[model samples]
Target chain A: MHPAGSLIIFTVLSGLGFGLLAFLGAGVVLPLGWEAFVWFAAGYALAGGGLLASVFHLGHPERALLAFTQWRTSWLSREAVLAVAALGMMAPYAAGSVFFAQPLPVFGAIAAVLCLATVIATSMIYATIRAVPRWHHWTTPAVFLAAALAGGALLAGQLRLAGGLFAVLAVALALHWQAGDRRWRDAESTPGSATGLGRIGRVRLFERPHTGANYITREMVHVVGRRHSAKLRLIALVGGAVLPAMLLALMPASLLAAGAALGLHLVGILAARWLFFAEAEHVVGLYYGRAAA
Target chain B: MTDLPETTDKKLGLVIDLDICVGCHACVTSCKEWNSQGYGAPLADADAYGPAPEGAFLNRVHSFEVTSEDGPPQLVHFPRSCLHCEDAPCVTVCPTGASHKRAEDGIVLVEESMCIGCGLCAWACPYGAREMDPAEQVMKKCTLCVDRIYNENLPPEDREPSCVRACPTGARHFGDLGDASSAVSQLVAARDGFDLMPEQGTKPVNKYLPPRERDRATAAPALEPVGEAGGFLGWLDRALSRL
Candidate 1:
């Protein structure tokens, strides 16, 4: 829950990139020749660059290929496999569109579904972690997919679709925050229970094992200032959802407006994603005497 | 390979007694010392001699104050490490199949060679059991001294986890918990040893023995006047009374 910059960039950029690819594959918009080339390049860059950024988060980036091996049980593995599959499948469709001006409907449709599946797999990596109660909810995936769809629509210049998806994203984000706020308490993993001292009495941490921070404390016990988080939440909502939705609704045909909306939305999503990791209260923090607020 | 075995032949784990552990951190230091040289990777420290030193440690002792209506607050030294759960979320979350549970002894371990160090396994653990090594950038956890536990090179008495061997108070017990007749299982049954965060449903193999209740009654006995104070005490008592 340290809110590593690499992961924040990876999720936000990849989500948007995949979202755009999904729309493109669905035949939502068809650009030909040089126009198609620009569109495909942007999509691949966002998606590929995001994937590349995620590799930086790994301690052994060279061994990342092995990550795709355990798809049977690991969501992270599934995510890696799905991402490669989505990117590989989209290649031919992108080539055809740029060269022959053919949309390649069949490949586009399959690639679109794979693109969405890849995003879902990415979300599932966090959603399945029961240790972080805030993330272990249906709303996690809901918010992720909503963000992807809305951001994708905005990038594709599909104002009507973007407007609708933005509304859904807003609802999903609200629901995710509302539920996440209560999840730690709902999980009932208090310091007493964590130490198994609740049976006798109330337990309070008296002394930490070490004087300095360790890996667990650095990774899992990140404490965000309440006021800071509140402001970020406002930025996420206003910039990510409200402003962009308003822009799309008011200036439905303005390419400049769409570009501005996309920019604001990315900033908003970045803030939201930061909050997503920073606000997460891992159960491990109970050992360090940091109560989930 | 990340999938857990249907059943492990043995559930080897630790049973730490909160009643006896004094938070000495002997086990903590010994664990780090033994594991650094014994197993996969040396426990790495960043800025060890500098300010803001951070390191990876497999075992740590946390001191907690427990207060009850019947008695004043008491300090409990709790040692935490990998529980080696029957359903370890850490193993299943490993992206590279580096994290795996032993079918033979039920010791969950990371195969360092395959570790990508993405840290999903650490996130899945609720107990803060796994720490990413600063130097190696790979996950480090309690191996239960796997090398020593089965090592023919060591004497029979030393064939246990370094933590268990280092504990001065004998609070740490390591054995096969799967066998109900094992000393650890019997101790758990007798002392009402319970899992940490049972709600998480990891079904942890490691168990903790709750601290025994403290005597709340005053230690000093009430003073009673003898029929007459004797000798110097009597004279002093009479003198004080007169004053």
Candidate 2:
């Protein structure tokens, strides 16, 4: 795919946003404190609303509800179902925390699990597609989970943590960056090896079968150079990972400062997400008179 | 036992010969004529008189010239449409179960009513077969002329697919590929056939016979002798010579 910037931002931004909300809801529903309600609601609202915003990137957003209909086979459908499920669980969990008496820790734990389910569902949406070899792997879903959790940890550090949470989140961010980097590298190194071609060889398209660009070419033949990607990675590491970690670590735990730090982290994560799609090479790229690697 | 029972053993499919196909687009024309009037949604053409126009076609023959240092220039005529793979990704991706693979014939079909126009099926396809009808906002592809082939009202001999029937060179064939002993299968086996992008693992049931062996000796059009008196052109030449 051409890797629409809007979609990249949407998935990553919404992922972090919702991920934090789910995590906050988890903390609220737990016996953490009723004082955490505003933070939790704010976080959930940000992420949930962000996720909803991501739908705008789709060509046919009107049919979004039908995305859940194929739960029998589609991972996308599973993701849809889980999104609704998380929303359902969080509404009660949030309500119990706000209007009613303080809820028990179990409530937050349930909300946490529901939030995690949404993350899994989102990840599986890309991972399930067998056609895109770069995406159709175990690492894809793992990477998504890691990024979401990392975002959640960063949010938690920025919001509630008094001392060492920043350090922990920094370490988590570093780990995620490393893992994501390796996945992107692996995807690049793997040549456009189609099925039935057992022995890999350096193959180049000497001739293309068409004159004008076809739909497949337009959609799948996107190429991002190594030099550009390297620069983007640097930006992501600095802006998305290292800087956010430093800001969260150095800054005071006031709502304004913490919110700013969270915002910075969110920007970084979005950049990282965009690079993730950009760096990943599709096998179909080979058909478009380009080297997949 | 003579008049006991009549068995309906029809295994309908498409057989495209890559060699004889000149990519004249006659099949595309014939297909549009049959399908537009036959069934389902109209394949609309946009901007017919304007600078740019787009239209839907069940069958489109693409001409490609594949050249290499190892072999001579090969003009490959690729007629693209739905292959209706047994493991069609489009079918699996459809949310409403609108797209389905027939158990009997292995023909993948879409039920228009259930389709929500998500366009996910289009993304799943590697062949770029499924096109979203802008008018109806539903996915459309080659149905292999389903409405006509089995229509008992049509004459028995005329029941063949329009494309196959219209092909002057006998390049396109329609038959059941499921039966190993069937003509289509036999033809495929006799001639080592190939499918487009088989690496996709769609397991497309449709088979394409490679270009026929060109007899280098007899391939070129034979020319007449310099002076053939009885020939029409020769007589005209003699008259012109006298003048």
Clashing pairs in 1: none
Please give the range of 10 consecutive residues that has the lowest summed lDDT in model 2 chain B: B1-10
DockQ, in order, for the candidates?
A: 0.83, 0.12
Among all windows of 10 consecutive residues in model 1 chain A, the one with the lowest summed lDDT is A222-231
Backbone clashes for every candidate come to 0, 6
| Deviation from native of the Cα of residue B74 in model 1, angstroms | 1.0
RMSD of 2: 9.5
TM-score of 2: 0.76
In model 2 chain A, where is the ten-residue run with the lowest total lDDT? A191-200
Candidate achieving the largest lDDT:
1
lDDT of 2 by residue, B1-243 (tens): 001112223445787887788777778788878877766777665555666546556666655444444445555666767877766777776666667776656666777766666566766776667766656666777888788778899998778878888888889888888788988989888877666567666777777877764534446777876666677878898899999
Residues A1-293 of candidate 1 have per-residue lDDT tens digits of 79988899889999999999988888899877998888888888999999988887789999999998999999989988988888888888888999987768888889999999999999999999999999999999998999999999988889877977887888888889989988976778998889999888888899999988888888899885645988898899888988888888877468888888888888999999999999998999999988535
Candidate 1, position B30, lDDT = 97
**Candidate 2's residue-wise lDDT over A86-127, tens digit each?**
766666666766667565456566767877787887777666
